[model samples]
Target: MNRNKDKAWYIADVGDDLIYIAEKLNTKANSEDYHFENELLMLKEVLETLESLECLKEHSE
Candidate 1:
């Protein structure tokens, strides 16, 4: 999901930022930090989805 092509892809910016942070914190061991990291990834997905929906709604108006 490369999104650099279009300025409408605001959600993509958030997704890419999360991916960057996720790459840096991968400790490869089970711990609270790992769980927290996973949660962040999940939240990123949810946020991107919500943003995409909002964009669609605005366009349909």
Candidate 2:
């Protein structure tokens, strides 16, 4: 098994998980739950950074 490829897949999975959590938070938050806003924004930023990572791209065989 290729370790680098496995690592990339793991990162991608984490990104997906973050997206799901962010969506759930968005749906659950209300006026009284303003704290969720910061958490959601931070998740978005982390996902963006993950997308920008070159290692996430699949190399051509």
- What is the C-alpha lDDT profile of model 1 across 4-53, one tens digit per residue? 34544656666776676566566534444545656577667767777776
Kindly list the per-residue Cα lDDT of model 2 for residues 1-61, writing each as its tens digit: 5867876776877778787876778666644555666666767777676765544555432
User: In model 1, which regions exceed 4 Å deviation?
Assistant: 1-34
Which runs in model 2 stand beyond 4 Å of their true positions? 30-61
TM-score against truth, every candidate: 0.44, 0.48
Q: Tell me the TM-score of model 1.
A: 0.44
lDDT of 1: 0.62
